[model samples]
Target chain A: MGRAIRQAPGRAPRTTRSLAHARFLLALTLAVVGLVLIVMLAVTIGPANVSLAQVSGSILGHLGLGATGTDSGAVPLLIDSIVWELRLPRVLTAAIVGAGLAVSGAVMQSVTRNPLADPYLLGLSSGASLGAVCVVILGVGFALPAAAFLGALAALFATLSIARVGGTITPARAVLAGLAIAQLAGAGTSFIIFWSAKGDSYREILNWLLGSVAGATWNSVIISGTALALVGTGVVLAATRLDAFAFGDTAAASLGINVNATRWALLGSVALLTGAMVAVSGAIGFVGLILPHLVRGLSGPSHRRLLPLVAVCGALFLVVADTLARTIFDPRELPVGIITAFIGVPVFIVLIKRKKSSAWS
Target chain B: MVVAVPGSTAGVVIENLSFSIDEQVILAGVSASVAAGTVTGLLGPNGAGKSTLLRLVGGLATPASGSVTLGGDEIGAMPRREAARRIALLEQNTAPSVDLSVEDVVLLGRIPHRTRLLGTFGGDDDRAVAAESLAAVGAGELVDRMWHTLSGGQQQRVQIARALAQRPSLLLLDEPTNHLDVSAQLSLLSQVGGLGTTAIMALHDLNLAAAFCDHILLLQDGKLVAAGTPAEVLVPEIIGEVYGVECDIIEHPRDGHPVIVFSAPRTAVAPMRAAASA
Candidate 1:
């Protein structure tokens, strides 16, 4: 065993027993600092020429601190309003949405004990899309995302129901059910979009298909961000149980996880986060699918390590993806969803080619 | 690490425990008492119901017509976590997950005792016993390694350590040494028997079972054909009647235990096959 440890490579020359512990601590410390920097950069980069001070001041004020609306109490409120009221919300929402999606993906992957199990593949985003579309186009229902939220919850429960038989959920059954239900919901959505028959409605729905932060507002951002923090932290704090989940059901059961209860808790939280994010930003893909996997490669697959790692990486990944989406096409901005897949795919392909880490055994 | 809670009786007892699956009677009508502080070997052949009986005992599978009592109480009535803490079962070929670390896998054994939702692995929760559990089967160094990277024999030992970490009063292991080498096989049985914890294991190796078991329960097609001390149950006549093989049951010189000397079955006139023309 000592020989194997020595052979693992990429360690300090001394290679004491404490080295792996030291490396983990270092990875955690660096990840935390890097996350803070990404948050600032994400908030700062935009088409609007808001100074860094203005960005910090608005953030501080939003946090209910003593920060003034104006940077030096000299500039007029006009520029501050543009920075605070307009671009800031979108950037913050991107981080919140990213964190929620990644954590959801991580938790989902653990619960199913299938590496391929992520929130997107389970039809959650598509379900949210169906709900949002129903409310927006039908004009007969509720708030913009509330309808979508319900849809995500419905899809989550439906999938669990389909997979479960006699109190046990097998990996084969779960993937099969998810594939069937996701396809079914997606077909229903396409039918609704085509049947709507109005050109303006088509464009609006199309814009949504390419998830945007164009409708970002402080109210929606606060709601989504708060939900993300509350639920995401809750999931992280429950990290140990999530780690047990990676051991599969009977082992987990003997380990005393009420397998059914744990499954429901993870699924409920994931569905809620997915619904809220999809409500705010339409159907952003790849961040949930790809970011968690990337983070796992850097840090191994311990959820205690994986969740926080993925949360930061997912936030940074989406924020950067959104920025590229806005900048790469200039005035004719591409949808953030387009940017995520466009950027996410090549990295994903490379990761696959390297065979350094497989999401599955 | 095995603790006896006040009023917590930790032995397993079966009374008329019959079970059927897919309309097939597996354990027809079985009754046995695996007393506290002894290792009971459930000895059987391929089609026997030893595994089924152990599953019912572990609370993994419900019996069709009877109950398995644990700690002198019906297992169905024991609180879920309470039951888990008192009894740990290890089955064969646990589909290894590549991503989990060995420590992460072992911490799972402590879950039944953890009341907090997060199940923090504090110093006490590390199962200071985990080290001993690992060392008993010689898997202590595998603690930090990724679980999937371990060799098959090493993996099996780690699993026993996990069950040991559970601090179970009654440990049930099913065919635990299937992939293990000879030394590992003897070493693991000695550890379990040495623990003085009540262990009822379904072991395929009759010789190993005879060497370690304080009591042997021979099952033929799910019925308890015979039971008692190893010497009493592992007789040459009983072995021939149950296994339908010619064998010699002799005293093991070193341990003064009964050992089997297997012999080829006597040839009988073949029941004629259908004629090729037909």
Candidate 2:
């Protein structure tokens, strides 16, 4: 190593790095502000006619802040029930699930060194679906969230064991194993649906499979929020070590990282976060897969720069998508996954068409 | 500026090193010592464990048995980060999954220097070192470019800059000139030779090795066949026996460096056209 003492950056490259940093900060700030506005807008636009002031008042009243209303009185009980009881938890769940899935996707891609990887790449979604199907169709008595979370964990363990069959788990082997398990679980889910799904239960299973935040309560908010706060933060904090992986495992090892240990830790964290999101939202698509790629063009590929913005963009994206899901069809709600896929496929095509993007190169 | 000093406390010593995979022996009972602040060329044909030896020496892989000591301290005993702070390896094959900017790639070299748990982002000093390393490798102008946008030769230079940014005392490179044009190959070697750090590079070209290396270790089937100065090791007798080719040694016109000129294999078969048709 050169001098152990640090030196100030030279004039030229300092400006360049800081400029990128400033851009990242600006994007993050904009995304956060957008998320807050969208959440408020989403809270007000539900089937129940609620104004933005009423929504804010309800939230403030519940937060123990003095409820300042247009009529100089407390917000109406009906408005409070609609906003706080009905819409707020749903929006919050969507946002938390979005952020968690996006961060998980970013970490997954980096750890596996695959551009196409997502949080559910390890068969978490298929496993969760199989669990939820059993609960809804077969009338299994386990709580829906518990069953789904356990199913996801089981899938993770199975995939990892298969990958570890002959030797240490490699990214290629894990991915392949995950694919195999996904297929098996997917077939199992299909078989259950085909064999036993009744009339009303079909709609229920379909809704869960397609993912919805319509049933989100404060409990959903708490579950997804705590997971994001814990695992998402750790993944973001490991950004530099993630960057060490850009040149492959040997290069990362030479840079002093324990390649296998770091990979396992990161993969485990991503699985936990993804499992939490899946348990709540039932495999909401596109936010995890598309959000990181969408923001990578703006934030660049460094996880330190890309992850925060991806989380924010993801939250904003899902909140908007969920709002559109409920309101666009008005009274009849589409699953949020349908909206995400509808939006995600087009955006993904556009991103792919922009072949000059160095992020993909 | 401080003169380039040996980053480790002393030279590296290897004793009876052995490595294998899947019950297949790769290297067996190989031993050598490398003096500090010198460039040594590790010369061998394909499958001779040259890459494996570099990985072992750089502490990227553990030897099945035996020890490699750097500056008298065993490498395997050191924490990964401590070993990384003293050594850097440039592997022959590596490609980023994402399209990273050249600066982002080079800044990764500063990871080991960070002490804080949350020090994930690079500070000003890292950018400076990255820039300095780029300039050192003559890739300063390429910093803003994306890694995938660079030509093969440019990419090689940037990769070298990333390694230089680590400012390692012991630099190990596997075939540093693999896919470069002649000019690029020359420039890259010259740049590496001027770094003043102790370096061990695997090379295929005898002439380049002879010109740039201070010492040479020749291997055959993962065993050291010869170890000496380039003049001592690159003689026709040893080259013919190991490489199975007829070759003549001639001194360079300008520098008097030994250059090997190959004529043909000792027992040449029919040409490729007839052989392939058969």
- The DockQ leader among the candidates is 2
lDDT for each residue of candidate 2 in A1-361, tens digit (9 for 90 to 100): 2321232334366677678878888988999999999999989886678888888888888887866445467898778888887899999999999898888878877886655466555677667777766786678998765666667768877987997756556655666787788778767777787787566655555565668888899999998898889887898788888888888788899999999999988977776777678777877766776888889888988887788889888898889889898989888889998998887768656654654342233
Name every residue pair that clashes in candidate 2: B10-B71
For model 1, report DockQ: 0.29
Q: Please give the lDDT score for candidate 1.
A: 0.73
TM-score, second chain, candidate 2:
0.91
Question: How good is the docking of model 2, by CAPRI class?
Answer: acceptable
Which model scores highest in lDDT? 2
Cand. 2 TM to true fold: 0.90
lDDT of 2: 0.80
